[model samples]
Target: MEQNPNKPKILCVKISSNQRFFILGKEDGFSVYSCTPKFSLLFCRKFQKTGISIIDILESSNIFALVGNSKDPNFTTNKVFLWDDLNQKSIMEIAFPTPISALKITTRFLFVLTKKKCFIVEIEKRSILKSFSINSPSDIKPSNSFDFSLVKRDSLHIAIPHKLRAKIFYTNITKPLVELTIKLNTPSYQLIKFNCKLTFLAVVSPSGKQLLLYDLLTGELYQKFRIANKVSKVYSMSFTQDDKIIALLFNNSIVRFCSIQLNETTNRLVKIENQMKNVYKKNLINIEDDTQGICEFNEWNDLLVIYLNGACYRFTFDEIEKKITDTVSFNYLNSKEVLESKFNFNIEKEDERKHKEGEETKTGITSDKLNENKNKKTNENIENELTDLVELLEEQKLEDNMEKEKGIF
Candidate 1:
């Protein structure tokens, strides 16, 4: 198919879990287009309307959530409508008290982030499981940040920035677990990107001088990338499923890629034993006309980037690496010289060093053990959530039957 020279401006774009499809949100309603190996559109399902601003899709399950502008047909920003492409119908919908700023979805739940609060709902039953106030004042629009735990599918966390401090809360708990206080006395950092696997959290400093990546599970300052050149802002970014690669978007249509080494010795799957290699200064070359938007790596590890102009670019990991081959470098911090061991003794040596210096190591070890225990407990909570979800689905079925008796569809 020939490219439309006058195609409607692309508002947003998302790739499927399988990486075989691309979802485009334009000034009109959104469309699903098959992504051919050559990056051409194989099929198009355009739902014409005034606009579709927010779109979240779990393409593997054939489910999507769309938020439309008020000008669109039967659309309102205050509500989210769930659609099943297989049925070609709206299965369920939820109305919020305020207009939604952003949203995310998985097989487990749908997260809606409004200006002042966040709402989480079970997908199968469309039942509200929990909601909380974000405490972001009316005038100061909140920077968007939310993701499900990468280590556990059912766990979720959201970071809300208010002034110099940021509050990060998990869905299963009411209290904030991670509160980031910047020493710069600035209002807040603009960019907060959380890896879904819960491996790391990336944020652009308020001064825009550095990019900070933190170890989420350990709360350690994993690495820092100094920003040499000044840019307007970081629009969006995403970590690959393995948390080994990250892509960032900056002003003037530039996207930079970085590689990460988690410093795992024995097994890559074990989270507790892994440490991060220090990431140092790296020069980034500019990409094509990406005025504004986001980018992410699909499950297949292919890079999918969408711009405000509605153009979507897909590149294999090798292709991206080749393009920025010489633009990346990193450093590893070793405070104490210790021999590398096959038994993953870097952590043990650090504990030993702390003990010899008369500095208590129990607090650090206790914290790591606590996180491991929390992971196990959350796993059990997920199973319980699923059981409750089944009951809620049954209730929905009964309600639908009564509505059918009343001749309502």
Candidate 2:
């Protein structure tokens, strides 16, 4: 079969647990980008040899965990390199007996997922701490199967998928034990995510139609939300930095959000029906082709949905005006032209507005000069009518006086 040209060539995109830096692994090399103001491309560096398949970087740090693809058998897929970007070289390389599948990096430990085992390695000591068996269907699965979070700036709060449930483990390297486990109603999970604060664990079922939010501490369900309709499919879901709002992309077209409030005093997520009340279903972007996409929330609570084809769409939500504006940019990865992501205009709506303004101007309604001339002509007509009325009154008075003077007396 011939390959579809529309297919995206980007291999993988990994966002740091901090949500500040995200790396794009292309067929050639991986480049890091900053999600600060606009999703700006920091720099691009291509490899002279093998392509990078996966990348996991520590939060806002130059250290990266890099994995190469197995297209060339000579370049073993069983190795993960600890790269120092500032020095521009690999400082350490860790090789496993089996090919590695996925990786999650942190300051304390590096979580490596392999064929049938999950290995935990100490970053400082460069020693393997433990290995556990996973009954995952395949050797390699989506890297989202597990997520890492920091507790009190030291402990590691890890969330992973068990048979059909979600497991939460807490360890500070001093004490390791099972903290809590969330009994899930869904048979399988598509992805699991922990908010940056490590307070909430968001789990989406395999169907991606429903969302479950759990209290990371108590392992209790805060509330379940309906993300999409039965027929619609949710491709991506993300939470804002404040954790007060969550957004999701549906049917590769529309994007919607729900309000979530975490009570600080109670240390619990509030339950509100406003989520269903704000169920807006508008096609934010009608893609020409079907594709899987991912969504991210920046510091300003703006929603950014990205596709593998380097197509990026941003929706800026203005709380004061209660309005949303969007902008689209293409070929973001390879192009040097920056994404003018200032969402000042909605393309179709802006065009329609200009057209309406043009029609109004043609009819002498919109132009200020045309309005001034129209008001001048109206004032002249009113003055002439007032003068004629005064003249009629004077003529009537003169006729009355002549009748009295010529009286038959």
Summarize candidate 1's per-residue lDDT along 1-409 as a digit string, tens digits.
1225565545566665445566666655555554434344322334544466788765333457787775533677878876544323454567898888877766567778887677778765558877766654333224334444322343455555433245444333323454443232224565677765555667666555566766655555556665426644666667777776777666566666666556665212233322333232222333344355566676556666655444556655543433533211111110121221111101122222211222222111112322233333322332343344334434543554465321111
TM-score of 1: 0.63
Question: Ten residues in a row with the worst lDDT in model 1?
Answer: 340-349
Best model number under lDDT: 2
Residue pairs with backbone atoms closer than 3 Å in model 1 (clashes) = 10-310, 150-196, 150-197, 163-187
TM-score of each candidate? 0.63, 0.70
Per residue, candidate 2 scores C-alpha lDDT tens digits across 279-383 of 344464446434556777765576667666566666776544545665544445555623211111111221221112222111110123223333333223322
Query: What are the clash counts of all predictions, listed in order?
Result: 4, 0
Quantify all predictions' global Cα lDDT against the true fold. 0.51, 0.59
Which residue pairs come into collision in candidate 2?
none
Runs in model 2 deviating more than 4 A are 1-8, 18-20, 71-74, 137-141, 163-175, 231-235, 271-282, 286-290, 318-330, 337-409
Model 2 scores a C-alpha lDDT of 0.59
RMSD of 1: 20.2
